[model samples]
Target: MRRGRIDYRMQRRAVLAEVRSGVRSVGDACDAHPDLVRAATHVGAPAREPCPLCGEDDLRLVTYVFDRKAPANRGGRAVPRESLARQHERYGDLTVYTVEVCTACHWHHLVESFQLVTRDTAVG
Candidate 1:
């Protein structure tokens, strides 16, 4: 099994830099698809900090999990953190994504991504 993780902080920082430097507009960055807008609006854990784009107190942290069997699994549905612990046992290969979103401004960023697999199944 492939065991690896990816962090998207650098990518997010690059995008933020573009926005701050006037190379990209926050509106452009926040102009997400309708489905994403709806999901970000209703799903995920509420964040305490205000939105970096619009200064709204409506940010949230969203998590999405995918397995080899279902790569395109569930369309941006909000999965509770507790559920992930259960998934680790069921799937041998899993990719987890954590995303931060500002519901009020429609701003969304991929916070991080990591792999999860059971010790019994992970290959050396």
Candidate 2:
């Protein structure tokens, strides 16, 4: 259940626009962390679109999950997209974050986030 979802397309567009208009350098826009690139290579889902910054076909979508009901809500883990349903069943009121990454250029940005319903909160 993707409830309370927030889309970050506008922010992504703004960042891209800044890169294009010389406000932000390509290095600034494409500098994904090492761990993130590793996650994108291993667990990321192939995106439908190419890398917006580099025009490469290596864009991937990585998903991370955190328990909203837990204290501090820290230490989120990167999860494969295929296992989201099982993950949702295991955690109550979870927060899921999805990011777009380009394995080629190291570009990355948060694309969307939403709450996952546990068994208790699941609707029929």
Candidate 3:
């Protein structure tokens, strides 16, 4: 079982619905920060789907892990997926946020957020 896991698929669907229904403009939906866009190009992993808004095949996913208890330089950085286990081991308690980015259109969204807890540090 996933401990402290939270999925944001529903929220993603809602935002897509609004964009599709014309309630929210495409500009608003695709407004990703410059830093995020840069990360998408440099460190992002390939996403399964194409850009939902632009229909480009430039979608990527970037995982950012943050731990308030960690030193300022150690927290709030994008880490590779392959090293997540190592990160959890080092941080003990961390919050991870996965973001989907379309480098083509600068579109981005929060894919999911979850808490990572080491076995020793997790509360029952």
User: Which prediction has the highest lDDT against the true structure?
Assistant: 2
Candidate 1, residues 3-84: lDDT per residue as tens digits? Answer: 5667887998899899999999978889756666566666677776887788888888777778756746454335765577
Against the true structure, candidate 2 reaches a TM-score of 0.90
39-64: candidate 2 lDDT, tens digit per residue: 99999999999999889999999999
lDDT of 2: 0.91
Q: Which ten residues in a row have the lowest lDDT in candidate 1?
A: 68-77
Quality of model 1 by C-alpha lDDT:
0.74
Candidate 1, which segments miss by more than 4 Å at Cα? 1-3, 71-77, 90-92, 120-124
**TM-scores for every candidate against the unseen true structure:** 0.78, 0.90, 0.87
| Best TM-score among the predictions, by candidate number | 2
Order of candidate numbers by TM-score, starting with the best: 2, 3, 1
Task: TM-score for candidate 1, please give it.
Answer: 0.78
Error of 2 at 114 (Å): 0.5
State, as a TM-score between 0 and 1, how close model 3 is to the true structure. Answer: 0.87
Q: What's the candidate order when arranged by decreasing lDDT? A: 2, 3, 1
RMSD of each: 3.1, 2.7, 2.5
